[model samples]
Target: MTLSEQIPSDARIAVVTGASSGIGEATARQLATQGYHVVVGARRVDRLEKLASEIGGTALQLDVTDEDSVAAFTAVVPRVSVLINNAGGAKGLAPVIDADLDDWRWMWETNVLGTLRVTKALLPKLIESGDALVVTITSVAAFEAYDNGSGYTSAKHAQAVLHRTLRGELLGQPVRLTEIAPGAVETEFSLVRFDGDESKADAVYRGITPLVAKDIAEVVGFVASRPSHVNLDQIIIKPRDQAGPGRFSRK
Candidate 1:
């Protein structure tokens, strides 16, 4: 059967981008448990299929940085009541003067434009569903900047602004927008940032306990389960040991 046909006509559909791992994966699982038919998307088809199998959801190959991929992925989604904009990352920790243009490009493309493309494509569906929620997984970087983190922080700021802008633009619309900004989450995030340097990645959480993927996922679930009239605008989550960016309370 076709993908759109597979989803029940009355099902409350939730589309999760970057669902292969970390926060995205956990959020997809959480939404599935809440009885939403979670349509999981990511660049990794194998992992997406495996996750879909476990959660009884649909898997679609997606690369948010690619316009064609976003178009094709959105084309098959029959309906969307929830959209988790979780496909984003950081690359390199270089100062502005020593920055790699390629890394900056990647951060902007993935974190900023990526969110824009997917959100814009599915907005009509979200609005048409009549009680839609858009949860964007931005970072604490969205709020503050630190040394050697300009590229990521800047992109996050832009992404957060983009999300916030919709709040006013979509005012009176059925769609609700929530931005979840997390701090010190231990996942593949650091590994990717450090370019497979396990030691560097490991050091990021050495002195303090960090937030895990499930923590953010549960919050998404909570927001999703809220009554349609309720709109939880913004949530900033951090491990107890973290005070802010680079202000970790180390043991």
Candidate 2:
């Protein structure tokens, strides 16, 4: 890390979940670049360590699906000014009738419940910090349901609800709540959704240009950097080629 990227002693700490890879990793790297002492959390200890070392931040082994792990992660952080909940992904492209219960469970656990656990754990610190930001990464599916996105869509919508409730419930507080919903950002998302089937995953964004993890990460930094008086409730960004859920311009 260069001197320019080093966080000052007085800078408020930023915590990002799922920091091992994808958007979480990108957000951590971007926040570190913005002079924040970023505390990264994920289940993959080795990757987290490497990311922390590379970005000059600290890493904690955290499994958002586990209450104990979330607690342990919060214990390691002295204070938190920004909390980015990005530990979510699609499980399977199954219809509602053919949905696998296990896949749905995993999606719910990771997307909705994971956000609940981490936010509940760190919220007190954010409240005490006076000025804080909470950014939750949802998906376009949260607003528009599709044929094969039953489980993923429902789970992401729950995250969106959680974000909305937080904003309404925390009115007048210094803490701000923002939800970022992106459309078809090419990352590990497709691969994971297809159960590591490279061909299936590759087909999701075959001909059209999709958004990247860094693109969303940059937006996160922008939203979080706004003036304290300005609260951006939500940002729904899609690639120019993506019109909506299941609508893509293929070349």
lDDT of 2 by residue, 105-195 (tens): 9999999999999999999999999999999999998899999888999999998998899988999988999999999898998899989
**lDDT at residue 10 of model 2 (Cα atoms):** 83
Q: TM-score each candidate.
A: 0.99, 0.96
- lDDT (0 to 1) per candidate: 0.97, 0.91
Q: Listing every candidate in turn, what is its Cα RMSD in Å to the true structure after a full C-alpha superposition? A: 0.5, 3.2
Please give the TM-score that candidate 2 achieves against the real structure: 0.96
**What TM-score would candidate 1 get against the native?**
0.99
Residue 227 lDDT in model 2?
Answer: 95
Looking at candidate 2, the ten consecutive residues that score lowest on lDDT are: 1-10
Q: Taking the tens digit of each residue's C-alpha lDDT, what string does model 1 give over 122-180? A: 99999999999999999999999999999999999999999999999999999999999
What's model 2's lDDT at 102?
97
Which portions of model 2 miss their true places by more than 4 Å?
Answer: 1-9
Using TM-score as the measure, the top candidate is: 1
